[model samples]
Target: MKLTNKITIIALAAIAAGSFLALAQTPANNNIVDEIVWVVGDEAVFRSDIEEELQQLRAEGSALPPNPYCVIPEQLAVQKLYLHQAKMDTIEAPEGQLNNQVERRLDYMEAGLGSREKVEQYFHKSYAALRNQLREVMRTQYIIGQVQENLTKDVKATPSLVKKYFAAMPEDSIPYVPLQVETQIIMVYPQVPQSEIDAIKDRLRDISERVNNGESEFATQAIMYSEDGSAMQGGELGYHGRADWVPEFSNVAFQLSDPKKVSRIVETEYGYHIIQLIDKRGEQVNVRHILLRPHVSSADLEKARLNLDSLRNEIVKGKFTFDEAARYASHDKDTRNNRGVMMNQKTGSSRFEMQDLPPEVATVVEKMQPGDISQAFVMKDPKRNQDVVAVVRLTSRTPGHRANLAEDYNQIKEMYLAARKQEVIDEWVEQKIKNTYTRIEESWGNCDFRYKGWKK
Candidate 1:
């Protein structure tokens, strides 16, 4: 049987902290007791731990199993086994990856909750404390993942094995494929007037001049004027490889030989930037930059829409095929050369589920039929951080259907391989529980568990 879904570390930590605070505030005569529920090897699971997990589940609106008391401890125990194995095998989570994950998770939480203060208030912990707890939890998760990968590294589902796995499956167990669509798009960015372009450049030049003349610090100017997210951090983009930055930015950033000198204004897709060298390590550079983007007026947007509309009219009148127009006229570098076919980044495929398409594209495509071309519509270009006009063609649509060997061979093969890996893990867990020292509180032992040998 499958184990419980992974619990969110933030939610668990919050619940645990609230529980402890509640206990601390209770009268001395209170009867509430928290005690050890189970011991797996050298690790102990507490009653409070189980309650925290339960509270987290409730908070997240997840339905509990028949007896979560029995289920949760087993899940925790299984995780401990993987972590213990990871320790014994000397497996380590890369520090860089760990830090990046922690920061990203914290950023997501802060964004959702409105601010760092709100997150800390809800969790009843300081920002640093929450970060520390998350880091430890993320590290444990990473190590456990490494251990599992090591165990199933050699397990492969060949074509014959995949066919056998599919053949033996019950009819009701077959997976259903969702309706998917393939679309082609031609995107044209609104042209910023030359006056606006010159204005942005002039401002950057003034800022650069001030910094060079010692009238102001680069970091100060960046914090006050830069439009990029790094502005809050004084525009410091930490040490990164040359490949980390766009070609134009990197070319100028690497050429800065003097720390005090600011580079000439550099133009990139995001905007215009002026860079100051901070430091350099073997093949890596650290620089600070201020970015300014030219504003696109309503007139510019209307012009772009009309241009795209004219192009659409040409395609409809048989002046040229949609593919030809996309290849020669589209401004989006990513899809222009590929004949404007939009790829699903999540699946690395040409097909997209309705929800997976961009909001503007989805809105237009939902009302369209195969071979229908949409009118020019405006959408945000996330890469360049600007508004652009686009027209799309519904290339094809596949209706939802049951998975079959003919049309969904790759999907079936992946499912079979994943099942095989989980089977290997389950077998390993069964053996590990037998070999490890485990003790369960008698009061908590009166329920069913999917794995054997845990009662002792």
Candidate 2:
């Protein structure tokens, strides 16, 4: 019983900013009990924290032991381990990212249970205070992840180990995998009108100069002018890696030096931007920026449609195959470069599943037969505030059901990689427990631990 309790606690703590502690329990009288339950290094665990966690679990209608208090010390012990590892690794996450994460989570929680106002009433704090608390907790959690990753990075499990692990699992425990594909792609962005591009760049330069001349604070200006969703929070991109951002934005953002100064106008597939550097350490950099995009012309769009329409007519008249016209007559170099093979971004497969088609194209292609060309339809990109005319060809279709080894190899490979990573991490945690100075309050002695050496 103790072993089961310990495992659950450790698993829960391993997730970022995960806390039952955020929930407030309904006791006979008060919810905020200030009593100390356990202490780890300099960190003290409170009875209220456990009760709050219990409240959340019960609210979710989760089954729990009648003796709920028995797990209190177990949770404390797990937190102590996580906190210690976090301190050693110096892990950090940005305040803005943490805040957004918390807000979205709270929103989901509210939808599931109650509103933020009610949540605050239960916690005895404002929404702002709760955000601050979660941010700090997440920061510590990041450290723990960093330390665990560093420790496990070298402990690779081989193919044989994976087969062994799979064989040990019960038949019912294996889930039917879904259809998935994986492919690598090099995207070619369509060329933007030179005049339109210049105009956006000019507008950004003007906005930057206004900030430079003391017109407004960079964040405030970003809030007013930035096109990204982060603009709501003063264009704070939050702490993220280069892979998270579009290539053009990432390229310029990493190059800027001054946090307070504005960057040169930059163009990306998304649109145009004037960026301001925020902070950097190692490979991570935070930035705030504003985007400006020019509107598309109806006249210009009709011109493109008329041109493509004529080319399509020529194809039907037997002058050329659709591919031949696509290579020479299409204005969009992105599709033209590959003879017009549209790849699904998520799956990276050359063949798009029905749902994989873009919304605008999907509506048209649903009624289309293979080898049929869709009439030129309009689609708008929010960043660019421009409508583009595109024609989709229904290349292939597959019925959905259980995934196969051949069709879902990439998905299976990812799952395999994840399982191996977890095994590596488990070993690493066992080692960390062995080396770290740990003193679990007498209450946790009954809990079974995978790391037997920690008993000392």
Candidate 3:
């Protein structure tokens, strides 16, 4: 979800520069002309590029990988290889997604840096100019990433291969596995009574009418009445596409061509909203909205709890398995189809460290053992920010220890697959270097590189 799209933007904080605008000058002295550090095919890796990347890494608190001047340039050179291939293949990044990503990135940077003016000052460019540069960078990044995915998406490791990979690893080099637990849950959102929903909808309809009649500015109304986090910014969701928003909301939002017209009530998992389109450019649309979630009455919440309690009792009495109940009854879209197993978003693993678990889940699970089903309890849903009743079962638990094939086969399989993928990429690079025109300045060729064929 682009709700935390800052993580993606923060990743680019180490991508070196704002774009070519910031890359036009070297660090420490803007007067010095940039020189080519290396040339891969038709693309030139400039000295300023290396310096900018190094500066960005330092700014992001990343440790330099021994002789950053050489390493950073090499990294840029490799990126150019993919970029070149992408161009040849005519890989086009969707403009709307690219613009939306750039907009979100800039929004995040502005908030983190304090203000839009500070962001402009930091980048040494106007907001529009900076956005243009970021859009191009994002486009290139998307193409490069797509190229890499194309190359490695089909690669897979077998159980035997994983076992062999694990056996070959030195005991001293084996990674320490943190204590992790896999959890499964059955969720039931507390039902908002129809009366409450109708009341909120009525209120929203009135607000929309008022805005339509010029009784209030859309942003002013948003700030005054919207419940979303963006209410502080007048419910301005910068610019985004269908991918970043709920389908129902996005459908109604994109259908509005006139900026002044407010959309009727739109219902989504989060709540009810009436959106006013600020502007639309290509696939990107900017909008301000007022969101009003129907309050779940105590009776409704108790109803949800009782429902879950009945389901829990049925599972305990062996009427049906927890997995079956979760699939048939759980309201969580993310885990329902997966047999109730919850995935840790950061690690992309079913297992989660205690600290990484949702606070409510963590607090309850701490007192339970493996195979223990927790009692139905009310907790705020992290995504929707609404009260939900749920019952969780600790599926599996592993103590902190050195990683081994028996208990951690999937992790070993991933490591093996990654190592193999790297080898494949290195081989591809070695061959591509030979076929493509390549030259490195002698001064830049002194450091040890992962691929030595570039020197050829």
* Model 1 per-residue lDDT tens digits across residues 350-393: 98999999888999999999999999999988677788899999
Q: Rate the local accuracy (lDDT) of all candidates.
A: 0.81, 0.60, 0.79
* Candidate number achieving the greatest TM-score relative to the actual structure: 3
Q: Write the per-residue lDDT of candidate 2 for residues 256-354, one digit (tens) a residue.
A: 897878988887766788888878856677788787666667777776666556656676678977677667755555667777777666656575655
Error of 1 at 398 (Å): 1.2
Clash count in backbone of candidate 3: 0
Measured with C-alpha atoms, the lDDT of residue 48 in candidate 2 is: 57
- lDDT, candidate 1, at 316: 100
**Where is model 2 more than 4 Å wrong at Cα?**
1-46, 55-136, 147-226, 234-265, 275-288, 306-357, 364-375, 381-386, 393-396, 416-456
The residue pairs found clashing in candidate 2 are 20-53
lDDT of 2: 0.60
Root-mean-square deviation of Cα positions for candidate 2 versus the true structure, in angstroms:
7.6
Count of steric clashes across candidates, in order = 0, 1, 0
> What lDDT score goes with residue 282 in model 2?
63
Question: Candidate 3 clashing pairs?
Answer: none
Provide the clash count, candidate 2: 1
Model 2: residue 284 alpha-carbon error in angstroms: 7.3
